[model samples]
Target: MGPIGGKSKLKEAAVGFALGAVGGCILGATEDPVDKIVSVMTTSGSLKPVMDEVRAVGALGLGTLIGATALTTAMTSVIAGVILAAVVASMFVAMRSCTGSHEHSVGLWASAGFAGAIGTTLSGASFGIVVELIVKNYGMVGLLWALSFFTVLKPPLRFVFKVLWKQGEICCTPGSEVRSREREHIEITDWQQRQRVTLQIEQRILSLEKGGSTSGIEGRTMWATQQKEREELERRKLENEEAEMAQRSIQDWINTVMVKHVDFLAFSGIPMAIVAIVTSGFGLFGYGGHQSVFLVLLALVGLLGYFLLKSSDFKFWMLVGCMGMFAIFVIGMLTLHAGQVVVTTAVKMRAAGRNLSREQISTAMNYQSSLEAVKTAFFGAKLCQLGLGATVGGALVRRSAGDVKVIAGAASVAGSLLAGLEVLAPALGDGGTAGALLGVVGATGVSVGATAATAGRWSSWPGTLGTIGGLLIGALGMGKWHIVNIGLQLPVAYVFAMINPF
Candidate 1:
């Protein structure tokens, strides 16, 4: 059984690793939005003639990516809050059972979720604002200093915030609290009645004793029963008090540690973005000294790991190590891909009996590279839309107790449609057109899946308002529709939340 359990745990770990890898790739592809947008615009017939449009688009993309990064951090925070709340809730329930208490007065989920939402929102907002005001305006100088700021200050800040902000407030739902109070009142009244009855039995026993009658024995029996009942009530009250104390301790500990973990994740994006910018800059320059960059990064990671090890912060170490390794891996892959693309283009030109001039080959490579950012942005937006739809579908399922089969069917159909549309991408003759088609299909899939999941929910006011709000925030306000940044920052956030790297 032990070996089997070990194997099962290993299998789960492998699955998680694979997910992390794929997610990292998706995020890495979307980094350096400003450069990518410029590249895409350079290739466009209309936008190429208008530099202002290109600059505006680039800024918009950058802002959107940053905001999406904030959203990803927020989501991870929510995940941490939910998981911590669940564990604490389970602990409290066990303690309650030991006290022979069956009352479900605790509304841990609502309180935890609310607190998490507020904290996460504030953290994201503050982080985003600081990055924009301080780091972004200075360009490369900003990136350099920002990197140092996050690496040095973030960990201590996480601890400080955890100590300062209580993530989990042990609050009951309003209705449940009212019900619990009423039950307590009834118990108090019953105890008072029991006390009165015991006093009456005592008086009767005394009277019987005075009368020197056999009825005194019956009165003694009644008095003994009343005493036993009173002792039982006293024992229950003591157990209740103990249970309450235990719950308070658990809540405090959870709030301290778990909230710190969330803060740690919430602040990770800035550093991740800085890393992406540095790597992407190297990519633009053909990375003549890429090895040096890798070595420097590895050394920094090692230094941090040493500190983490000294502190016995295994989780944080793991998160940092995982991120460092993946960044190296993805950077290596992109470098190889760029080389391969240049070689492939040259080979095709030669095969077609055309002279592969250095200038022509460079032009081709540059054009191809330029399209990457546009593709990444479009793909990122589509993914965010799909995720939003899935989230809504999941909620509807929970509320309606709906069949999972229908949702599954809708997703499968959407997947098939996406696969079919993929074949038409090259035929579109332009990378931007192909990417736009992908987004359209994704939006359509979201609509179909959401409606199929729960038509009633889709038609409701909450649903309508949510849809409009999402559109306005993701599309209109951002100049492109996206919720999560499909970039290096997201994977970092996820790993921190999942592994609790603090």
Candidate 2:
């Protein structure tokens, strides 16, 4: 029995590795690393482009790692991996012809796709091995190995894309040059018009000069008319020059502002996102016992990061960097939390109503069911948080005043706090009818009110009140009172609350 169990474990690990590699390859291809490298390189001439590419690669690598890790079931992992690879390979092939690179021919793309699949497969295999080793050792060494391998692989993958981009294996137009040429054309056309006017004025003057004079009074009048015409021509010429100057100045200002904004946003957002991720990571892993502290710290970091990124001047990479860091931090923290919940729940269940051996407790705590539940809850929370954040962020983005934006942010915070209370309050309460009833009422009321409030202005108090009343009547009992419970029991209700809110 022992030998058979060991064999099964090995088989599971092997399957996981194979699936992970396939999945990684597919996801990697979707990212179009080569195109991204080329874009950055063309726009920015320095190590900046390379660094940017590295960041993108790192994000994708981390995502791949997490995704592979989550697919614990061998069959599911394999299926997911194969599907991911096929989709990514197909996309790459489809886009290959669009680049207009004969050297990066259909054959070359096919070859690259095959290579990507192999690399991804290897990555997945490495992840599976690392995970298995970690499970066995349950030590810092295993964690370090995972992190180190990921860090090393990220740069090389990025470098490959960078090299391909440099070889002109991708194509993107130089927008600045295109705009400049367009402006030059407009200026040239204006200049031609001015020349034509000047020629017409000269022809009129020559015609007047060639005509013979009949009388002194008539000649004097003709002289006065010519003088007026000359003055008018001079005024028109001055107006044309002023218009041209104004147009040039406006164009120059626009170009300068655009460049400045892009640079500022990039600089500000990238650093802010990185800081948020690092801080969140430290809070999660460093102060494990004080989870509330970590959660608060993480939230603050995210809020600060959002503001810092938003206040930036609109640089493309700044936004990219910010998003990249955000994704990394969120996914990492969530994964850690999920793992903790799983381990804790398992231990609690195994040691239920007993003073069991530490080893027994530990072994029981690592049970698959607990881990799966924790993982699901963690991801579900993340998805909810992200969706809510996006909605609030989108709303605030439209507001020009910082004060108004702050109000929107406050609403988001309030909503999150309410949701947290709904989840945590029930856990704290004793398992009794009264406690359960109170939790149900409180959660239903808060969820309804908050959902309505988030949808629009505070003036919708009537609608908010109606929603709460409806939830209380329809979902307060029958084991369907919890927000999550409601979400599962009545998906339409949940969606309506999210969208309409009334």
- Best-matching candidate per lDDT: 1
lDDT of 1 by residue, 1-502 (tens): 9998666655544433332222222222222332243344346552232222212222222222222332333333333433444354544443343432222242443333233323322332344345334422454235334544554565676666455443323343233344356458658967796779978868768978898555668868977887787787776667666555654544454444455444544453433444444443443355423466555545544564455456554454244433433333343334335434876979987999977888766555443433433333333333433343233233323333232332333334333434543464344333333333333322222233333233233434444333323322322223232334433223222222222222
lDDT at position 368, candidate 1: 41
Show the lowest summed lDDT stretch of 10 residues, model 1.
51-60
Query: Estimated TM-score per prediction?
Result: 0.44, 0.31
lDDT (0 to 1) per candidate: 0.40, 0.35
Candidate 2 lDDT over residue span 399-457, tens digit each: 21121222222333333433443454344321121122222221222223233333233
Query: Model 2: clashing residue pairs?
Result: 21-120, 21-121, 21-124, 262-315, 266-318, 346-365, 347-365
Q: After aligning candidate 1 to the native by TM-score, how far in Å is the CA of 204 from where it should be?
A: 7.7
In lDDT terms, how accurate is model 1? Answer: 0.40
